[model samples]
Target: MAVFQAVRANQEESMRTLGQVKPWCAGILVGTVLAAGSLVPSSGFAQESVSVRAALVKGALPADDPSASAWNSTPASEFPMSPQVHWPNRIQEVTVKSVKVRALHDGQQIAVLLEYEDPSQDPDDAAGLEFMVGDKKAHFAHGQPMAQVQGGPVNIWYWKNKDNNALDMNAQGFGSLKVQDQQDVKAKGVYQNGTWKVVFSRALSTPDVEHDTQIKPGDFINIAFAIWDGKKLESGDLKEKGSQKAVSSWWYFRADPPPDYSAYYYVALAVGLAAGFQFVIIRKLKKGATS
Candidate 1:
């Protein structure tokens, strides 16, 4: 008890000098909340089930151009290429066809398999969604293609370069067999089946990590299917390079995070407190000299 008190006192004192007391306090509060086994999120880390619905829109796409892939090619990072996950323009024309979510440790997620039809009859290369597993990019394609990662592999990730009409490992497709971070969710596109299909999956863990431990039963999961016009990539484009313009899909994973620290609010509060303290000190000295 004494040691714990001493540690708490030290944490408090550190905030005073560092002008980070509030953030520290907030962090502590958040930590306590999680430790007490009371799970909830103030924002991004909130534990709840998110459902998404994306049915064909009115004249969604002309049946004549059913082969056309949505999207107009964006950076490797970001989706529809938006930083915000819930952005309106990010990915549209999507719906939660089906969702099966479970818990994995402190985090939860929704796992699903999306299917898009490739109405395009001609063979075309596909530049599917690109998700980040750490710094590495997970490119999805109609047929699996070459891969290189700046960090470690997403463990259970792989792509089949087989140029089959359907994106089957027993067929052909590229995706993150493993997921590093929810923020790492990237974008890819391809025309598959008799229409264009782009599948997206998001797995989030409260722990700040690129990937999280696997999922177990009873964990709450959130799922959404956004519809985004497939960003068209040139034949030379990465998403559409090899066998482009087929169907695209991505699989995200939840990895484990080391048990430490507090919630994001605490971190933000700590920073805010530090900033406020610095501001107060500066003004305090100025006023003191004037007085």
Candidate 2:
């Protein structure tokens, strides 16, 4: 009986010592993994912004104006236009999120849902999102909020062509937008059937956002929505018989755009709780064996 008690006592001490050692191992391993992951390249942004209510989701009308032909938006089966995007990857297929607006006077909220079809699937090559911040010229994380960078004509748009693939801004709001690796025109591109979700948000860097406003969080816009599409080159202009075209989508939020408030909190929580916790548990086992 005395031996039995002694054995159990030893076991408890062993466990306690293991516990203290666990944190040390965990802290080091986690820190190391994080450091390495940081070095490895990833998408410019971590979590992407979702479909938001569109103050304006505009695509340049086909120079030919296909809308004149008239097509049915109410499809019995699926989207009418196939993934006509010249190169699906050029116009990255991603889910747009909800956007909200608020009143400046009374701080009222308006909500509108924005949904888009993300048919793009070329993970090997990807497109980019760009905006202006002033004369300094800044870049936006692929899924970060869009804000007015300059005081006057604070325009923001990304390039679509190979040469202009980088994001650029011009006063016209349309001059900078061009297709990349463009070839003879086909059914250029379309955002066929896909998941639809929306978010409620407030404007970020517009003139109104910078200035003091009565609006608070949770305010939403009523008519918020977005529509995005890309264009192609003329058929005869292309030299190759089977040349391809590329297109892109531009987006905007209406009713007072919202600041991205949840990315930092959500990403940290996921990595810290799930990934971070797993590291801690593994460490406990290793230390126990060492002791």
Candidate 3:
């Protein structure tokens, strides 16, 4: 507990000092710490799954471009879901057993293809409707118990087909979701043969946005997914009277980085040892010559 508290304190102090002095540096420091495994678990799930390498590409893939079809060949990471409940509000177990995700990246951009099974196309009806809590427009989702946290906000890219398009949401907790106006995300959804394949693409880093997580080639990030089966009438309860349910990915869907080469400390130590060994050999040769 003390160690955790100390880490929190140091992190807070560092943010306060660095954010004001150099925001870019602060962002780099935070990313470095996260990548180093000091904060979040930087590993895959205990269960075995295919590795989805965000293979480096020359440019970002286009939404309808045929060349992007190659990404479909990559191995997918399957994730299971556990039904979520909030007291009287119980969203039964997800309709699908697992979701398959494949990712591709080109140092500067990332594209993720999410595939899941759904019998019918269930599109979101309410895209612009204000989420209300009692009489007032609530900043977050109402009736969701575990939605809000001081530090854990989720970035969601939701697709409502081509008509409603995609919405970029910053969710602090269940009902407390804010739509981002200046979203950089692009998504395309295709429902055919009783399956839904959606692609989400975005810039690896958005420096001006605090809500965005800056991603690089070799950085692990937690990704969780939710599916609202439209056929089952799983729309927002406030709009549909609490019957709404979504199959949610197990607490986290871990995205592992490609080959990581950021081992400067170890590399420096090895170099020093090799130099010292060479120096010792030279000294022995000199002593031998003198003798």
Candidate 3 structure quality by residue, lDDT tens digits, 135-252: 2112223323443523345566666653545676666556566778777777777777877777777777786345554565554444555555654344543221222434443232
lDDT of 1 at 119: 29
Worst 10 residues of 1 by lDDT: 71-80
- Encode model 1's per-residue lDDT on 128-236: one tens digit a residue: 2332324444333322344553333222222222342222111123343333333322222344544443333234433534343223333222211222223334764
Preferred candidate (lDDT higher): 2 or 3? 3
How well does each candidate superpose onto the true structure, as a TM-score?
0.22, 0.20, 0.57
Q: Given candidate 1, what's the lDDT at residue 257?
A: 41
Off by over 4 Å in 2: 1-55, 58-218, 221-265
Q: lDDT, candidate 2, residue 242?
A: 15
Off by over 4 Å in 3: 1-53, 62-67, 86-88, 125-150, 162-164, 232-243, 249-291
Candidate 2 structure quality by residue, lDDT tens digits, 1-291: 999999989867865866655645667777978997889876573112322222221232222221222121211111111221332233333232222211121123222222234334221111222233333322222222237753322232222222322222233132333333322111111123542222222233334322112223343311112223232225533211111212223323223244567999997887887776677678666757776
> Which candidate number has the best lDDT?
3
Better of 1 and 2 by lDDT: 1
What's the CA RMSD for each of the models? 18.1, 20.2, 16.1
Alpha-carbon error at 41 in model 2, in Å?
A: 30
* Positional deviation of residue 261's Cα in model 1 after best superposition, in angstroms: 27
How many Å off is the CA of 212 in candidate 1?
13
Clashes in predicted model 3:
8
Question: If ranked by lDDT, best first, what sequence of candidates would result?
Answer: 3, 1, 2
